[model samples]
Target: MGSTADNVTKGSCICGALRYEYTGDPAMTALCHCLSCRKIGAGSTTFTLAIPSPNFHFTSPSSSSSSSPGSTHKNFTVTHESGIRLKTHFCGECGTFVAKEGAGENEFPGLMIVNAGTVDGEGVFEKLAPPQAELWVKHRVGWEGERHGLMQCAGFPDGL
Candidate 1:
């Protein structure tokens, strides 16, 4: 993807029940293995891309899903871990966790985390928001000795 400010990327939940688009590049992208991430149902950490809230928005509902004003397939689950509150949004129909927004001592207040797996595997997803770091590596399970090429942080990383 080009480095244009208006470049936009598309994403959808499994079964395409929920769709979203984020403009430009992400603020940060990282793989996380924190306890909180695991507690939320992920076996270990989550692959996330940080995008400015202002640049993210839901796209038109697909023809297969409801487009009526009364539609509500986009739902979420909320959980708190280590005093951090996070809301994981998913498609109620397919249960695909698509995005997460939260508050924590080290969380970025201005950006929201998008589960990179939900997005298209095009250049934008691979290059524009490819994980550049790993967080909470100390919480990684069996493969604790493995390493990701990105920045490594045993706990929270700076500028995250």
Candidate 2:
């Protein structure tokens, strides 16, 4: 159903201040319309890939970056309206959100919810598996038509 761990996928933030590399196939992919995601992305919906924590790691800053040791990114934690806690990591320099880490109580604990748009390389976005679901469909804006045929849930799927 997906690529193997050997197929490395690399990405970074808008300014390349935060870089990352992940191995193996993503656990799942989805288009989220939740308020938390919308605010973070400043868009109607956010495309995300859920990768196991062990498979995802932040790469070293490029030589041109002024980022010093241990200053790769910044973290912002928020408690979702649904009662789940999330800590979002953003590029320290450009403020581009890189990924999100959920508290243990989250539906996908230990999974890194990566911002799919940050992924680099030609046709890379198309290479990852297609989104399997759409979360928080109730919050989807009217202008954005439905993603027909995809599993649409009002909130995070139970036990996902």
- Number of the top TM-score candidate: 2
TM-score of 2: 0.86
lDDT by residue for model 1 (58-156), tens: 775542344344453454445444455675666766767777776454555667788877776545444554678888776777765556578888775
Q: Which regions of candidate 1 deviate over 4 angstroms?
A: 1-6, 39-41, 60-80, 103-107, 122-125
lDDT of 2 by residue, 25-78 (tens): 788899999999999988999999998999888885642343354566777788
Q: Which candidate achieves the best lDDT against the true structure?
A: 2
Worst 10-residue stretch by lDDT in candidate 2?
61-70
* Model 2, runs deviating above 4 Å: 1-5, 61-70, 104-107
Lowest-sum lDDT 10-residue window in model 1: 63-72
Enumerate clash totals for all models, in the order shown.
1, 1
- Report every candidate's CA lDDT: 0.68, 0.82
lDDT at 85, model 1: 66
